[model samples]
Target chain A: MSLLWRNVFGQKTGDDSLAGFLGSIPLFAEMKPRDLRQLAALVHPRDYDDKETVFSEGDPGSGLYLIRNGRVKIFTRDSSGHEHEIAVLEAGDFFGETTLVSPAVRTASARTLEKSQLVGFFRADLLDCMEKNPRLALRLLFGLTRAMSERLHLADRELKRLHHALHELQAEGQD
Target chain B: MAESNGLTRGHVLLFFLVMTASIASGLAIFSSASRITELLHTATTGIVLPVLLALVLSFLLEPLVRLFERGPLTRTASIFLVFALVASGLYLAFSWLSPHWAEMWFSLRTDLPRYLGRGIALLKEAQARVQEIFPYIGGFDLPSRGRVLAERLFSHILAQTTGSALKIGGLMVLVPLFTFFFLRDGQKIVRASVGLVPNRYYEMAHDLAWLISRQLSQFVRGRITEAAIVGLVVGVGLSVTDIRYAPLLALFAGITNLVPYIGPIVGMIPGILIAMVDLGIGAQFWWIVVVYLLIAQVIVDNFILIPILISHVSNLHPLWVIIAIIMGGKLYGVLGMIIGVPVASILKIVIIEIRYYRQTFALPLGEFDS
Candidate 1:
């Protein structure tokens, strides 16, 4: 009877449980255990075969996915139609966080490098959570905002470095 | 170029075959609709209606359960608490309203024949006036025609009423049991069902299910709320005017109001008929009742309750709404009419999302990989 209850409610308590894994994610690190459990209930766990396309460039993105196991390659195509590998993400890495805040097209494609497990937390789920549990929704939105801010700062530094390199190249041409 | 031309021709042929198959299937289904409806109706009445009703109940009660869960209660505790509260509330409401309801029912039983006679006479008088205007038109036996029509209508209504009463009695036991299970294990059920989708479409399917469920929940909750408010307002308005059987008429109004566009007008008929019969057609009180019903059902309900509760829930075109209601009435009667709009809305969402997903994700990994 207890086993049935646990299975139905997903009340498994341990580091291996979905709520535990969700809690360990940096984005959800500050959330309460109860909130984490509630959020876990809304997520979908999926398995992908090797070389499976998760999403393609220009596809409408709807959610953030946390890698549970195996590796995923994020890449994009230039005008010349050459694939540029952006990052190879392993288990525990999360992507597609931007779509949580607004509807957007994926600027890059994601494909699995090996047999992989992923947990998706969609915008629809977030919106529903906002309606039912605004406090939990606020915590999630705050976490997403912080993560995006950090990424923006990193992008800013990279852009400054590229600008400096371009300046040096122009000076050399002038000489 | 030759190979590309062959590939294009093959694609065109495939498309043609698919379209032809689709059209043929659609025609077959349309032709066999009556048989399908019979099968569906039997299945629905036997077991499915209870489950469907329970599902709707669970959806309506979910927010309250969630609210309870926000406190110190576990989900199981919350569900039980909600059940207890609902049961108690129903008990109280029944106890308080039963006497008034009984009186109204008794009055309606006694007065129904007179009202019918008056209504038929009014119709006959109008027919005579029309014939007088058009002398070429021949007279028919109005009383016999009216009697036959009334008999048929009443018998049908009685059959439906008896069936519904039996279902409602069964529902007393089944609904709570089903609702409890649904509330307790709904997430697990959804997860297990979604788990069946192949990996290629898993995310899209998951998102679609969530989106659809949210829309359905919003729509069901909104419509019920709108109905309750409209019913209460009409009841109060009628009571203020001291109309006969106001509670019964209000209940009728509330139930009919679930069907969009045609419902409010249908709801107004019983009240107007009662007023006309009791107070005579030219009585000032009859006009007052007409004005009050118009205000309650039309001006207040359409302007206030619908915009507030249901406007954002469904954005169906008026033409589609009418067509859905008519088709629903044709297929499943009153239940069909009530559910038609939401079902149509769900189909619209499914088509749009499927098309969007297909457009966005049709490109194969091999195309890029190669």
Candidate 2:
């Protein structure tokens, strides 16, 4: 795609398309004008099929991923085989930024709700970004934390649900 | 973030301060191994024990905590119930084990010397006959340096841990106390933490906490499950093989397996070494090891651990895990390596949170108000 086209739109913005919406994604927000201009040099697009897991719960968290279009559902399964959906991250929502600092096993599995387009960064690229723009790196943390908070809430709910189920079972015999 | 909640210039300054502090501390700690040991020991004694207890408590007591939160117990009562359960379990286990352990100890003291003498004689005779069976096996002989090697390893660990000159007991009680408050006022703590940030950065803080907790929980819980499975598999396998000290070896395997990346290796070393050195069946021992490690690798790390962890964890690459393990080990030795993954993952979430905060606060500050 042409530079302006990709820039204005998702990757490059042409005049008529959805190019103007590029500013919202936290990943691209902190780029310098010159850097943003040069992004056309580096940006590559990836495609994922619907219901296909882009990443699993314990995959290598090597890098960050940007969801340019479509939706992703991040969920966790408990020991008793209960699966709890944590978040429905939509476009402009950036995921997987936790890989750079703690590329430990993944905490949740991510799968596409639909065919999706994403841009990703490996550890080296992220470190480079941190080196050049530390503020930008911090912003990435914020976005990642949002996703995490969502999951914590889910864990809290899960704990509560287990309690509720047990209580209901106990009351059932009494009733 | 809405333009209404733009970050002021002070917010920008605070950002600079945090970044500099994190970077400076990183550099300082990186400069000295001794300092790193001090740092690590500080955390292990301080944070690790409470976090571990809290985690186990959370798991074991979640049901009770919920009951207390809901009805007559309320949240605090539920906490008490959880404690009650924990205390009961500990009491039961100790009572159960104490009588047997005392008996074992008395018998062990009495019989070990005699067993050693007999074992030595058998080994000596076996060594003489080994040459007749296979010339190459006869030359290898028993390891003479085993005691020295063990003493060295223990001394090395002691030097780092004790040499730091830090009074471990007096150093810090913040971890347990902090963990206590965390368990009690986790909500308030999170709120107060997130509340410090201006409204502009709230989303980031929220997200970061979510991600960090999830990753930490997944890793910790997975390791627990992984350890249990490894211990069970190895314990069962050895018992089935008619290996001596099956229970002890199994316990050792389970405990060591918590060290991840290096865990299985640490667990295997003693098992394999025992088989080779004492059993006197080198080829068979080596074959047993291959089969043992392969099965363990499949059942625990691969089939069991990966699935359980991945269900809720951020997909992390194995290379990164190894790197984290190495860095953690280098920084804090065993404890660091043990806690490395979750800590590292949490830090990543924090970093991401910091970034999102700047965006919410910074971008709006620069924008011209309508």
Candidate 3:
């Protein structure tokens, strides 16, 4: 697995090849090849060893990091110093999406669960590209909007389930 | 473990060696750049000034380009449209204002000595009043000394400008070309510059560049807005008072307004000189103009435009600003002074980024490990 990871990262990355990777991610999926190539120009490939931090909780988030290969764990530590797992993100998954729109501190820490290759897309470059090429920017924005709405819907469902369970427990206790 | 310990020491030693060597070479390169700027200023003001002017002009006009982008125009088209608009506006303004400008220049040349004489007389009268109050300081010949100093300073600025006017005119033609390309392909230019950053530091470099660019844009936009308001107010006010060279003085005020704190004072000099010439000493109108200028400058610049328009864009301290202006002026003349604030802010950002990078990447050793 490590050798494969090394070989994948070691291969020469053409702009089109990078664009292909970005196209799989929903946030950039809607962009045409030409537009994707322009967007891909902003991505910086980074490698991490197993358990190495990508970013820490409360760090000022500056960009999104997409896992090109291997897995990453997103977690937070509570006051008692116990870690709560948020999500185990894999290849094709991108985190820190919130920073693309605005600069805000990270709510959770990201660490490589195994040796990984990631690509960073900075907020600065994203905003710059959007300004220069608004047509492409619109497409990317539409994709991001869809992704966000889906998340919101999922969250709403979770809230409804939790509320339903609370009502059931209350009724039983009252009886 | 011993091998790792030796390697760490070797790394530390190598770091210090590289740091010292880089600093020394950096200073050497800086001096060479300063020398080249001086040479370019003297030999090819046409080339240098156009590029410099275009840079500043692009910064000022970026918002217009962005505005047109919202209206379904491509970036290049928007840039061209903005340039065309500016060109027509300038031509119209020049046609109307040219005659007045020429007449003002003629009057200034012919009446300059008379103005200087009156200024000297006014100074003498003030000196007499001061000496009467404090007789021990009576021997000070401030009036003649001040006249000589003012004459020298005025002539120096005039000489510098006149010497470069022909070259500057030629340069102005090229400014639109430079500005057009800058507004159109500025992002490509910036993105290409990312190649200069090493892989490990690429993200930080890209982020810093954007951060600086945004801050500078805000600063330049705010300054231009402030300058326009102040210039209009000062011009109209002075013209209303029948002051000579109202437009020219107003233009000076607007340009110098880019400099902080001392800028308004420097800008007020020509207006005050005109007042001294037109109304003479002890004249109620002269005092009125002086009072009006003081009130206008204080009220408009300090009380209004700065707070409302230019609200801490660079976030530079007053002391650092003064120092930066001085250093910039010494290095690159007027242009340096104008850009000092933005440059200083960029340096500040670079330092902050370095600190952040260090904190993030530095070895996280336990207290016992070190």
Best by lDDT: 1
Write one digit per residue (lDDT tens) for candidate 1, span B1-370.
Answer: 5666567777989989999999999999897997898888787765665677788899899999999987789889999999999999999999998998878776776677777888888888887888889867756777669867876776676577768788789888898999999999987798799889876556667777776776677777888888888888778777766468878888888888887777778887878878777766565465546554666766887778878777453667789989999897787677778778767876776666566556765534446542
lDDT of each: 0.81, 0.60, 0.76
- Fnat: each model in turn: 0.30, 0.00, 0.19
List the pairs of residues colliding in candidate 1. none
- Residue B270 of model 2, lDDT score: 60
lDDT of 3 by residue, B38-116 (tens): 9877886446557767887999998889888877787788888898899999999999989998898878777877777
Candidate 2 lDDT score at position A140: 50
- In order of appearance, the predictions have TM-scores of 0.82, 0.46, 0.72
Q: Which model, 1 or 2, shows the larger TM-score?
A: 1
DockQ of 3: 0.19
lDDT of candidate 2 over B52-115, digit per residue (tens): 5555445434445555555545456667666667668989998988886667545544443444
Better-scoring candidate (DockQ), 1 or 2? 1
Q: Is candidate 1 or candidate 3 better by lDDT?
A: 1
Q: Can you write out model 3's per-residue Cα lDDT over A60-121, one digit (the tens) per residue?
A: 56788889999999999798867899999999898988877876767887878899989988
